[model samples]
Target: MPKSLHPDICDKLRFSKLYEKYAQTLSNILLYKYGDILNPSDKVQEAFIKLWENCTKVKPEAVKTYLYTTANNMMLNEVKHQNVKFKYQQIKPKDYTNESPEFVMRKKEFSNRFEQVLSKLKEEERVAFLMSKVDGKTHKEIAETLGITKKVAEHRIYAAMKYLKNNLEELNKK
Candidate 1:
């Protein structure tokens, strides 16, 4: 199989014609929407590749709309995510580190609490959370680096936060 035709669906694509007509339209929409942020051309090509991979699943009547929607959604999400990450990175601290006895004691206590809570997490969850928060990566980037879905990356992060919150609260009471 050339991958255009799956066992259940017919291959209705005229590859050159379809590519020529839809490619530029998709690229233009993404570029206009996400300009000066990331490369829309690459994102368009990626969306087309995804479409081609599942060509059999797409009906000829809806392929254009499907491609456009997928590309647009992807680009918009990427743009929003980039903005959030930029804002997060811009947060600066007044002091680089605390050196006083009281500050050092609090830091050690927080570290111990963090380590205790971290030990309770599943190995994969801990690694994903650390890679995302400590190392600083967006969910999509973390997903790509770990070969996992963005949803899974998000879930792991959420679980880690919940665990840390609970553990830290307990530590505070102690």
Candidate 2:
């Protein structure tokens, strides 16, 4: 067992000291396990908050277990909520009526062009763009999902849009 799992000499765990010691490690563990689905850092912070709230009940030696359990439960709830949301969205009908044939044709052409341009972008940019535009994820959500900063996610999405716009303009001329 790791020494970190054991209690220190002091019976009561200090929030600031405990956070300083374990925050990054806990975040890394959650990220490694659940990065694709949710924001690990947010979950880690939530776990710590829960720990702080229940500090008196938790044994110092069991703090690590408590954190992991809290984080896992929070993630599970998020997954369940996402699943319900997905199911509800799946049941919603999409409307395509009241459109001219020419408009539909142009839309199809634009979509094809968009796909082509997106494929040509760098992998990171393409991913960010797809997550933001196609998947309808916000910049922060994309950053969390990709384990990147929000600014980086925004930049990648912007670059992708610029690339697509330039390519689409060139395509129009051809």
Candidate 3:
């Protein structure tokens, strides 16, 4: 008999069954880590989506690990975003009037350029970059969560930062 290249869960029926079997466990894991602030059910769905997207790469036995890692990463990102939003909300609207027209236009331009540069990053680089910058994770933590080598994660984050810096500076000079 030949060994299968993909996990059994890569099949639709098997994947659905796996989801049914592990969905509660995934939700509970998220709840334990974050209480209700992170939306465990929603994170569970997102983890399953990721699992399906990477179905061929995942081994059947490691499903739990994969789900747990992704769920934790997702929660961390959400927490960062929530903190930023809360801080922004606390600022008085009077701060908006302090910007000169020139500053406003430049700020808008820079934001557009930043989005474009970010969009240009490869998926791997973007993931590593956001994990490092947004979630404030170390290379080792990023690698363990992403299931990549620490060296690879470090390289990806470096490449992403280099790309963003070079592109944004060049764009601003124009």
Candidate 4:
């Protein structure tokens, strides 16, 4: 893969100027929509890279629309997948009845409890937990990225789970 889009490639048939201008525009749109869920700039960059790879097929005028559409679609899919996972996990959201004081209190309590439990974990265990359970990285991938053996990755993840379970139990009693 080419590390960067070459000036020569961009200069061809005025595609370069269009790509530059619209790339920024597409990135801004993506940032506005998905900045909270994921890295919007990363998604835009990925879309641009895809377009650049197929530059022969893509017209300059169409690049902006295509990039924005592609990034938004990808972000939508991500959100859908997250929703499904959250549902499957059976983690119920706090009940809210139109901005009541009780609802606000419950919401705050949940947030504080979650943070308190998470903060007790060791750094590596916390990272392993988030990567595996939150980001959905497989043990093998986590092991490879963290430069540890697969067994170590598994151990770290299990330890984190045990810690969280115990903490949740302790919280329930209080």
Each prediction's whole-model lDDT (CA): 0.71, 0.75, 0.79, 0.70
Number of backbone-clashing residue pairs for each candidate, in the order shown? 0, 0, 0, 0
How do these models rank on TM-score, best leading?
A: 3, 2, 1, 4
**In TM-score terms, which candidate is top?**
3
Q: Alpha carbon lDDT of residue 45, candidate 3? A: 95
Task: Report the lDDT tens digits of candidate 3 across residue range 20-139.
Answer: 877765675466455576698898899999999998888887887888889879988898988989986875554465779898888889888887788789877887787677667799
Kindly list the per-residue Cα lDDT of model 4 for residues 76-162, writing each as its tens digit: 877788888887788666665678898788888877887778877887777677778866779997786556899999999999888
Per residue, candidate 1 scores C-alpha lDDT tens digits across 1-174 of: 244333422344564567787776567545534563577887788777878888778766666777788887888878888889998798664665549878887888988877777878876677677767765768997676456899999999889778887768753465
Clashes of 3: 0
lDDT of 4 at 91: 60
Model 3 clash pairs are none
Candidates ranked by lDDT: 3, 2, 1, 4
Better of 1 and 3 by lDDT: 3
Q: Which ten residues in a row have the lowest lDDT in candidate 1?
A: 1-10
Regarding lDDT, does 1 or 2 come out ahead? 2
Model 3, global lDDT: 0.79
Cα lDDT for residue 120, candidate 3:
86
Lowest lDDT sum, 10 consecutive residues, model 3, at 25-34
In model 4, the Cα lDDT at residue 22 comes to 59
